[model samples]
Structures are given as structure tokens and as C-alpha cells.
Target: MVQRFTISLDAELAATLDGYMVKRGASNRSEAIRDLIRNALTLNHTDKSNNCVAVVSYVYDHHERQLGSRLIKHHHEHHDLAVSTLHVHIDHHHCLEMTVLRGPGEAVRRLAEATLAERGVQFGHVNLIPLKEHGGHHQHDDGANHVHQRPAL
Candidate 1:
């Protein structure tokens, strides 16, 4: 069942939303609004699921008072979840790193929060995928018959 509601917006905000809808090729206002709400909910996590993968990207000062070292150490501490990391030197004073993590949703969320909370870190973004845990360890007659699932949903 679907419930309908009416929302009133000012002229400027409505125009801006309409512009976004037109630029993005969204089918309708409902679709665009649903996507925007989904994105906001994705970032504002509140679930404690154990089957999820998340990509945590952030920018920071690489030489900001041992921050880089701390970040590296943190990754090392959770090596199982640290799937891969991409580092880029944006400029003389800025560094960007995208870290892909897989494990419990809570663990990944905590790691992202911790990294983002560090001093000198900025513009942190995390994308999470919730997955169904079908008992990672499965038995099979053939070793190549098993298929793994993607991180986070």
C-alpha cells in the first residue's frame, strides 16, 4: 500500500528541485525525491547488521601532525575489512584516500566515523551495501561451485 501526501515548497526551492530533476533525467518528482531520501538515509546509518560492505572516501592533510600514520595504523588494525585503499596526492597540501571496507555493517560504520573524526580529515563520504549472510562457510562437492556476494547493499 502507498500513502500520498502533499508538501509545499517555496518558489526557489521548487525551481531548484525541478532543475535537478530535469538535469538528472529523473522520471518524476516521486522518483527523484525517493532517490534523495535514500541517499540521505544511506549516509545516516542506524542499523547494526553484520553483513555489509562500505566504501569510505576521505581527504586530509597527509602531513598533519601524524594523522597519516594514525590512519594507516587504524587500517592495519582492521585488515580483514580493509579490502583496498587508493591514495592520491591532490596537491602539495591535500591528500585523498578511498578505502573499501567489508565486514559487519557496524564495524565498517565505526571505522568510517573514526577516520572521519580525525583531525585534518575533510569531505568524508561512505557508501554501504547490506548483504544477506548465508553462512559464509558452505559445503560443496566441487570447490569451484560457490559464489560470493557483493559487499553492502
Candidate 2:
């Protein structure tokens, strides 16, 4: 079901919204407004205990003392939260690492913070996506039970 409502925007704000819609390729005002609202809610609704999946990415000096070992230790410390990592050698001196993590929001954020705070780390960023777990377990045609998680939006 869809709910309909009326909103009033000033001329300046309405024009800006139209520009935004054009930049984002929104089909119409309603679509653009829906996307904006979803983004706002997602940003504000994530609490410490909320379940989330995050990607933490950064570039670091590969040869900086024991930076590599420390990075490994950080991941090991939060082994359960870490799903996978991709390492790319940017050059002889720098490497890029992107790690995917899933767990409680607080824990994921802490891990990303620690990793990004390391001495040699630079350009660190984390994208956290809140998730909602489907109620209980279900079985697919394969006869295996599993749980599903979808983006909170």
C-alpha cells in the first residue's frame, strides 16, 4: 500500500530539489522525495545495537614499520564481524584494503575506527548499511534453513 500526502516547499527549495532530481536521474518529484526521505531515515535511525553491514576502505603505507601486522591484528580481534577483505597493491609504497564487516552497529564502527586510526592509514572511509533480519528461519527448495537480511530502507 502507498500513502499519499501533501507537502509545501518554498520556491527556492523547490527549484533546488528539481536540480537535485535532475542530477540523480529521478523520474519525478515523488521519486526524488522518497529517495531523500529514505536516506535521511537511514542516517538517523541507526542505533548502537542495530544490525549493519559495512565496508571499511583505506590506503596505507605497506612498508610502514609494523603497519601490516597491526592491520592483521585488528581484523583478527574482530574476526566474527569481518566477512571478507580485498587487498590491492597501489604501488611499491602504498596499498589499498577494503574489508566487509557485519554485526552490531557499534562493534562494526569501533573496528573501522581502530583500523582507520592506525598511524600509516590514510583516506579511510566506512560505509555502514543498516539491515533488518527477516523473522525466524525459512527453508528454500534446497532444503536448507537460513535467515535473510535486507537493507533497513
**Winning candidate number (TM-score):** 1
Q: Write the per-residue lDDT of candidate 1 for residues 87-143, one digit (tens) a residue.
A: 999999999999998887788888988989999897798888666666364557776
Question: Residue 124 lDDT in model 2?
Answer: 94
Against the true structure, candidate 1 reaches a TM-score of 0.78
- Can you give the TM-score per candidate against the true fold? 0.78, 0.76
Q: Tell me model 2's lDDT, rounded to 2 decimals.
A: 0.88
CA lDDT scores, all candidates in order: 0.83, 0.88
TM-score of 2: 0.76
Model 2 residue 52 distance off true place after TM-score fit, in angstroms: 0.8
